[model samples]
Target: MSTILVTGGTGTLGRLVTERLRAGGHEVRVLSRHAQPYAVDLRAGGPGLDAAVAGVDTIVHCASAPRGDEQAAAHLVAAARKAGVPHLLYISIVGVDAVPLGYYRSKLAVEKLVGESGLGWTIVRATQFHDLVVRLLDGLSKVPVLLLPAGVSDQPVEVSEVADRLVELAVGAPAGRVEDMGGPEVRTFPSLARAYLRATGKRRPLVGVRLAGKAYRGMRAGGHLTPEHAVGKGTFEEYLARRF
Candidate 1:
C-alpha cells in the first residue's frame, strides 16, 4: 500500500479524508500546524515541512487560510518537488476564478501554483460546506434579528462526501482539474436561515440586507454555485437535524 500525506488533516474535510485513507489500509501522514511529528505551519514558509513530506508518494493538500494560502502552496509545492513526490491533490472552492473576493483570489492563485508545480496534480473544486452555512446563521442569530445578505444563495455540500471524493482522487492517478462538486439543491440564505431556526427552535425576526461590494455582487450572481454538478446527496435540513 502507498503512503499518503494529508495536509490540514485535522480540519473538517481533511480529517475525514485522513480517516478514510487509513481505513482503506493506506499509511497516512497528517501534516498540520499543531500536530506532533508533523506540526509544521504551512503559512509561515512551512518550516520543517521537508521531514513531513519525505518519502510520501502523494500529498493531499487541504490546509488553507484566508490570508496566506498562496504562500503556503508555494512552500508546499517546493517541498513536494524537492521530495520528488508524485501526486499532489488540492481541494478548492467553486467559482474561485470568477469570485472577486480576496480569499477566492488567493485560492485561485494556489490552484495555479499547484498546476504549474511540475508534479502530478489534481484539483477539485467544491461549493460551500453545510458547516459554513450553519456557522453563518449561528453568527447571524446572535442578534435579535437575523440579518442575512440579500440575494445571496448557496449550495452547501456535506464535508464527508467531499472527503470521500478527495480520498478517491488521492488514491487514483492524477486527473487535472476534474469536475466540480456541489450540493443537491441551491438555497437562499433566508431560506436556509429558516431551516436553521426550525431545526434549532430559535425564533427571531429575519431580515435580508443587500450589501454593496464586488464580492457580495459575485456571490449574489451565483458565481459560487454548481447546479450542473449537484452531485452531493445530503441536504441542508438533514445536516441541521444531525447537527442539532
Candidate 2:
C-alpha cells in the first residue's frame, strides 16, 4: 500500500481525507500542529517535514493559510521533490481565478506554483463548504442588521463529498486541474440567511447591499459556478438540519 500524507489533518476537509485514506488500507500520516501524529509545521518546513516527505508516495495538501498559501505550497513542493515523492494533490477554492478577494488570490498563487513545480500533481477547485457558509451567516448574525451583497449566490458543497473525491484523486494518477466540484444546487444568500434565521430562531433585519466591483461582477456573472460540474449530493438544508 502507498503512504499518503494529509496536511491540515485536523481541519474539516483534511480530517475526512485522513480517515478515507486509512479506510482504503493505505498508510496515512497527518500534518498538524497538535500532537496527534505526523505533527509538523507546513508553513515552516524542517527536518521533521523532510522526513515526513521522505518515501511518501503522495501528499494530499489540504492545509491552507490565508496569508501564506504560497509559502506552505513552496515548502511542500521543495521537500517532496527532494524526497522523490511521486505525487502532490492540492485542494483549492472555486472561482479563485475569477474572484478578486485576497484569500482567493493567494490560493490561485499556490495553484500556479504547484503547476510549475514539475512534480506530478492534481489541483481540484471545489465550491464553498456548507459549514463555512453556515459560519459566515453565524458571524453576520451577530450584527443587528445583516448586510448581504445583492444578486450574488452561493453553491455550498458537502465537505465529506469533497473529501471522498480528494481520496479518489490521491489513489489514482495525477490529472492536472480536474473538473470543478460544486453543490447540488445554487441558492441565494437571502434564502440561506432566512433558513439560518429559521434554524437558529433569531430575528434580524436583512439588508441587501448592492455592489459594483469586479468581485461582485464576477459572482453575479457566475464566474465561480460550474453547473455542469455540480456533483455533490448533500444539500445545504440537510447540512443545517444535521447541526440541530
lDDT of each: 0.94, 0.90
1-244: candidate 1 lDDT, tens digit per residue: 8999999999988999999999999999999989888999887755489999999989999998878899889999999999999999999999898779999999999999999999999999999999999988889899999998999899999999999999999999999999999999999888899999999999999898989888988898999999999999999999998999
Each prediction's TM-score versus the true structure:
0.98, 0.96
Candidate 1 deviant stretches above 4 angstroms: none
* Winner by TM-score: 1
Question: Could you tell me how far off, in angstroms, the CA of residue 135 lies in candidate 1 after the best superposition?
Answer: 0.6
Report the lDDT of model 2 for residue 86: 85
Relative to the unseen true structure, what is the C-alpha lDDT of residue 133 in candidate 1, on a scale of 0 to 100?
Answer: 91
Please give, for residues 1-244, the per-residue lDDT of candidate 2 as tens digits. Answer: 9999998988999999999899999999888767355678878888888888888899999998767778888999999999988899999999999988888889999999999988999999999999998899999989899888888888999999999999999999989999999999988989989988888899999999889878888998887787888899999889889995
| Clash list (residue pairs), candidate 2 | none
